[model samples]
Target: MPLTFHWFLPTNGDSRDVVGGGHGSPATVSGRDRPPTVAYLSQIARAAEDLGFVGALTPTGAWCEDAWLTTAMVSQNTQRLKFLVAFRPGFVSPTLAAQMASTFQRQSGGRLLLNVVTGGESQEQRAYGDFLDKDDRYRRTGEFLQVVRGLWEGQTVDLVGEHLQIEGAKLARVPDPVPEVYFGGSSPIAGKIAARHADVYLTWGEPPAAVAEKIARIRGLAEKDGRSVRFGIRLHVITRDTSEQAWAEARRLLDGFDPETVRAVQAGLARSESEGQRRMLALHGGGSDALEIHPNLWAGIGLVRGGAGTALVGSHEEVAERIADYHRLGIDEFVLSGYPHLEEAYWFGEGVLPRLRTQGLWQHPFDTRTPPSAQVPFAGAATAR
Candidate 1:
């Protein structure tokens, strides 16, 4: 199968500077020129759809808008672009979540994908009235998926588990085509559950060697469970027409950050219980200097943002090469985004995607959504009179 690519919807907010808030960190107030509004998010969804992204990942957490509501409204503006809705399992009942997924699938023409995020921070959990520790939260997620999966398969689920209890719960309309589960976690318990359930296992963008190790470890667990799953990497992307332009953009974003903001965000992120977050911290070492964690990969985003903090930074061709390298190492899917989403979408969509097409690695999954020869209207398309 051709490799798949997904983009992100910055649900918290968007800015020229990196907007920060996640993994137990407080939402830092910046001059967010683009609020995460329905209209702005719809623009991004339509742009990603036109760019040929398979789907767009909307995050779940206290810091951001509700993923379900945002995606449902945006889905109307899009034709075939799927919504990879990320939601914590323990917060919602399994039966309700299953039924909601069925409704979303039926309404959106089966364009619904699920990203199960097991909450990692105890304080963040307690903010929503959840007191479960890190380990217990994973345990609850395992139980949660079991029940949701059973219901989606048209099975009458009767579960009296310690975390969840559902009696004779079944989806009246099972998703005609069930949404693929995309899951990510770095902990041992998280891996066990992902191996048992996820259709596509996701990891944060780490170095090639570390990523290979994660793929192998997940493959081993999946094999023991008689299952096989695809792997995906979630990262941000910064591509430009030339290497100089790309590096300049990266440096601009880096320079926008004040020392105080970087220090505060890094301090908060250091307390994150998510192993992936820890690995991200390791890459940048919470220092103001030395960002390229790997070739064409920049860790400067982690200085403020939570979750997927790294980004692929280089010229369009180099970005495509880095992506191709990851594909060779067992990553068939990539979920990416950038600082100011709209402009960067065009950069990657036009600059990198065409190269991938020539290499036979990608085809816009939804070419029918736009005019066959539609092109982005770059500012430089015309010179001043």
Candidate 2:
């Protein structure tokens, strides 16, 4: 399969500095210069569409805008960009979720992708009235997908699973093309669920060896079930004309991290029930030193951010090489973002993507028109200030 790329919509907000929040940490509010209004988000959406991104991911959380509602509104502003809406299965009924996806698929011209996030923090889940323990949440997620998938297949589902019980669940009109399911988790249960249902299994930015191990494990499990699952990795990015410039940008973001905020966010994440969060913490160990855990891969982002902590930081060619390294290990998709999403999208879209294109590793999914040349100058000098 051809490689695919997607960008993130910082629905909580955007900033030149890193905007902290995810996994269970509170969003840092001091530097959020751009609020997530429809107008601003639509600007990012339209930019991602024109730059050749297949989709944009809107995150789901109490800290961020509601993914379904926000994407539904933002979808109206862009013609071809699919919204990879992140949603928790436990917050809503499976039947209603299925119906809403069917509606979104029809209304958005078949531009919908689902990122199934099994809520990982107990305190946050309790706030939303979901009381299941960590492992049981994964179980509930499996059951939820079962019903949702059956309904999307135009079947009237009747299942009495351990966590969810549904009867006669069917969509009035099934989605013309069923939305692809994107899922991620680091635990054994998560692997099983991905094997059974996920069209694409996602992992956070780990080193090449770690990611390869995960791909092998998931492939083994999926093969046992007579299935195959594609792979994707999520990460922040800082690509520039030279390695030194990229590292300088990384240092700038790191310098902006308030020590107190890092301590508080790290403390909150320490209590998280997510195995994935555990691995991320191990990469930097809640300290700021030795953050370049791998060549051109920086862990400084994890100091304050709660999830997807590591970043690919290098010149455009080096970043493109890192992406190819992952692709050789079975990752077909990359979900990427940078500190200030709008400007960074242009950085990677114009800088790194064309490099990948020339290497025959990627092609635009929407049209035959070529993307802007890698040499095209970006006008967002304000981001540097």
Q: What digit string (tens of lDDT, one per residue) describes model 2 on residues 1-385?
A: 6789999999889999988777677744456789999999998888888788899988888788899999999998777899999999999999999999999999999999999999888888998999999889999999999899999989999999998888877778999789999999999999998889899999999999999999999999999999999999999999999999999999999989999988988888898889999999999999999999999999998888888999999999999999999999999999999978989999999999999999999887766654433223456455632
Question: Candidate 2's error at 367, in angstroms?
Answer: 3.0
Candidate 1 structure, TM-score to reference: 0.95
Candidate 1, run of 10 with poorest lDDT: 371-380
Error of 2 at 103 (Å): 0.2
- Model 1 per-residue lDDT tens digits across residues 159-204: 8887777898987889979989999999999899999999999999
Candidate 2 ranges beyond 4 A from true positions: 369-385
Q: Give each model's whole-structure lDDT.
A: 0.88, 0.90
After superposition, the stretches of candidate 1 with alpha carbons farther than 4 Å from their true spots are 368-385
Clashing pairs in 1: none
